[model samples]
Target: MRRRTLHLAAVAAAALLLAGCGTQRDGTASPAPPPSPRGCPAEVRLTAADDGRALCLTTGGRLRLTLHGSEDRPWTPVTATGGALRPVNAGVAVRKGDAVAAFEAVAPGTARLTSTRPLCARRPGQNSCPGVQRWTVTVRVTAR
Candidate 1:
């Protein structure tokens, strides 16, 4: 009787453990882990490849965006919609080089970031082309 009880208890504990280990077999993502002791997780990094997509973040999360430009047509500085995402720095994309911007999720809301450059590269004293290239991403922030 004692051995049977122990075996049953062990089986019950194993079942509970397996149930608690959630899996994404349904093609849905699990929830984000809770923040660390510093009240935020590591900064979420983005690149030019992320353009035109939407992202989700939690309050107190950090975001970093980096975009590279061609030799002649460098990208302009980046901008944020503000309110939900607060700029951690000047928020301006670097000029004449790879652009970078950083922000922190402050509130539960939506925001957008954008930058642009002339589509056609021009030589010195040349008139710039009317066409332009743009990069943008939308961010949805949720409360932690």
Candidate 2:
């Protein structure tokens, strides 16, 4: 009887250990989800510059722009309005070769950046050109 009781106690302990392993130290079942990306918004805000040359934004801020294209249709930068805002290193390609470019506010002023490339639709054996696709984003940087 004592042996049986000891065996039962060991099994109970093992079961409790397994149950606790799934829980956090604070007793929550799992960790919270990570916060959304910084400097990215669901909708782009269009603000005009005082000089009518660029859009307005805050210094030290960033703007995230995403451009979609086929695997063979990559985007290239056409123009950057001012020196206040500059593109970050290199653009990143996501699903199906879609590209994402990030621009950082470097100073307190106005700026704009334009990117262009031929838009194409790729089929199994051929590609169709719709025309040149141009994208422009302007910013007026203010002191942080």
Candidate 3:
């Protein structure tokens, strides 16, 4: 009788071990996928100074970008010129997707809201120098 009891216990232990072996097998659920790539990949290339960030290399000194006002907002771009992005003018409202007023950080880093011009531009020369409202994102710059 005792021998039979020992045999039953061993069999149960083996079954439990086998069950755990397949826990991570095909029967288990798969992990989630990584984030999708962005339309305009946020990156910047350089020559001598690499700060542990992404980059791009080019020959000519041409540029690549298309400034767009904030999504639904109505702010305009004044003078975006920092890191890599830029704006055409310097006297428009500060919209969401609109270009920034003036950027000058020519490296790889974040571009959050530094300053902003919230309310309507009612003051005197607010039309000429539209105040900034918020910084958008980290702009990578490839020195020319």
Candidate 4:
């Protein structure tokens, strides 16, 4: 009886161990390549208005940004948006050398531009009062 109980317990423990065991994965899989930094080569530089705000636009090297306002007025919200940007001039493809950098004050009320990742946002205040945004840009290069 003692030997049988010991044998059953051993079997149960072995079964539990085997159930918990998993195939040992080998080494590591290399990390996936980074996304293209050449995403935008186009650039736009704009002058701010007396109210201290403006919007800019560019399609691959060609830049177009507009400005408006009183810099010291109560803060207003703003947003920037784009669709399939077609050139005012023809046969211009929005490619690497072609840039897309434009921001227009959609409205005059409490609106501002927020510079997030790949795109910028233009809209009125957030869930509260006025909002100000700051953006930093960096360019990088890597082997294909």
lDDT of each: 0.75, 0.56, 0.36, 0.33
- Encode model 3's per-residue lDDT on 26-123: one tens digit a residue: 43322222223532233322211111223232222222222343353344433333434432234445445444343333443323212233444444
Error of 4 at 140 (Å): 34
- Evaluate residue 17 in candidate 1 and report its C-alpha lDDT on the 0 to 100 scale: 85
- Give a tens-digit lDDT track for model 1, residues 18-97: 65542245633334334456444435788887666566788888899888887677788788886999888736646565
Per-model TM-score on C-alpha atoms = 0.63, 0.48, 0.22, 0.18
Q: Please say which candidate is ahead in TM-score: 3 or 4.
A: 3
Q: How well does candidate 1 match the true structure in TM-score terms?
A: 0.63
Candidate 4 colliding pairs, count: 28
Off by over 4 Å in 2: 1-54, 77-79, 89-97, 122-130
RMSD of each: 11.3, 16.3, 18.1, 20.2
User: Candidate 1: lDDT over CA atoms?
Assistant: 0.75
Q: Which candidate tops lDDT? A: 1
Tens-digit lDDT string for candidate 4 (100-133): 2343222222222323222223335734433443
| Per-residue alpha-carbon lDDT of candidate 2 for residues 31-128, written as tens digits (9 for 90 to 100) | 22222344323223332111122235567677766655556666663356778877775455465545566677778766656666566755677868
Report backbone clashes per prediction: 2, 5, 27, 28
- After superposition of all CA atoms, the RMSD between model 3 and the true structure is 18.1
Return the TM-score for candidate 3, rounded to 2 decimals. 0.22
